[model samples]
Target: MPSFLGSLRQFVLAPKLSAVTFAERGFPGAGSAAAERLEAIPQAVVCGFEWGIAARDLWEVERRLELVEQEQRGFAYEGAAMAFTVRDAMAGGRGTRTRDLLLGPAAPHLLLAYIGIGFAMARLPRPLWRNIMPDLTGTLFYPTMTWLAVDGYGFDLAYFHPEKYIGKQRVPPPYPWEGRPDYFPRAVDQGIGRALWFTGGAEPETVTASVARFPSERRPDLWSGVGLAATFAGGASADGLARVRDAAGEHWPQLGLGAVFAISARVMAGHVPEHSALACEVLAGSSVDDAVAIAGRTGASPADADDTMPLYEQWRNRIRAELGAISGEQRKAS
Candidate 1:
């Protein structure tokens, strides 16, 4: 049974599973298989969150998540991670539940789980934000990769209020995350880019068109988000992914960088879905191992960088440039 606060959180925050359907969200291609898959992603997150918020023990959360299918189990973990983060934050920093979840069973799903922290960031107050994340300092992707939570916060804003953020292209004021206020909006834009994937029902052209509507300065990050979604959530086929890559044109490197990141996350999670495999081939033009290796070889510690362009951006630029060179070689060969 869920704790009282957990139930309250669920009642107030968790959406009805049916409510996330593409049709309900006013997304295109409501009845398509792609839409169905994309819709299920949010539903899984909600279910995990509901369970995590209410559970009396970590074992309770773990047991419930095990019931989810293997493919979506990571999403469930993501949800639980979000729940724990929110609960811990609300607790005023006395709990280690979020820490335990990530360092323990949830480590493999660290990518999504970290994004889950962003979900907490959205729901909690800014002051409480400090408590939302545990001490993940020495871990892989620590500190720097927490940029993903900013991404997640961006995704939540756009997803929950598309008309305001997505349709209107409203830019949220920047927060001094990771001691870098200037880069905050860019990270959020990347999340918005990810949201565009779902909002467009994974249609390459539709997603690309929506991206074009943004200011040219913003399109590169938007394209990067699109590439991550195309590679990870995958509502399209190989041809569709190819369309996204070509549509990216000058920002193709950003798109491929997103793909490389997606592949790295999936590989790290230890389950590469068939669709992800295809997206990697189409966008990154490489096998899963190579894509993951590319990400691995690109950057390491977030130990150094200027505030305007942090180590995180450095990592992304390196991946983007490497992908660009590879594509250049491919084009020359063809």
Candidate 2:
């Protein structure tokens, strides 16, 4: 007994765009344009908010790590407790239903957030719920929405895994096998096979490639906006903030605006104060080397090293350096 408005919400939120168009096209002003496109694209509007939450969580985790490392006393237990809470919440449910509901209508939105922002965040690899919750919530949300749309509203989109339909359908035997003992059963299997067949040379390749290409293994640029967002959302230490700022500055100068947007969104979401000057400080100046130096000094401790120094930072740095080198060559030629 789903309501019409509920059905409409779910349908409008599903992902539905070609890979070539969404990923490879590289539209001018991709950040702002992409944000607008995402807003307009049905389900994508919620992505920024999800990513903001992730950034905040990661920032909190890093902050706790820094505190445990530095204080080694009363704060250590608190830090551990905080970290455990994030893990537990992620493992169980931290507004998962709400997130699913928000993203239910948009398939591409979920995909893009998972492959693009989620992968970039590296929250998918860890066992902690904080890392895995977004993906799991997204997975459930999309399928449920699809089920509702098809079963309740009579839409014709195919399911992600068609195997679930095997026992639901009955079919006649094929060819001369009609009289054979196994013919009827075999025909049913054949129907299932037909349903599962992919006539196209390959399933549309988007998320897999994006995930594969993720720069999780490298050092991130300090200036990338995700880092900035993480900082303003609170729970990050001064040192963590410095690392994020440095990483963004060193690696993702172009993404500075996006970082600002992320911070703004966090404030708007009520996760942080509305007018924090930290956002402005982090976004100011061309001090990549200085920021990197600060991060090296502050974030070089054992705990920071253990967690791999923020996946977002690693990715931003790697992408920025490569892009910078390419831009350098172009500038040299000019």
User: How much is 273 displaced in model 1, in angstroms?
Assistant: 0.9
Which tens-of-lDDT digit does each residue in 149-266 have in candidate 1? 8999999898888999888999988888888899999999999999999999998889999999999999999988988888888889878888888898888888888888888888
User: Against the true structure, what is every candidate's RMSD?
Assistant: 1.4, 23.2
The best candidate by TM-score is: 1
What are the models' TM-scores? 0.96, 0.24
The worst-scoring run of ten residues by lDDT in candidate 2 lies at: 149-158
By lDDT, the best candidate is: 1
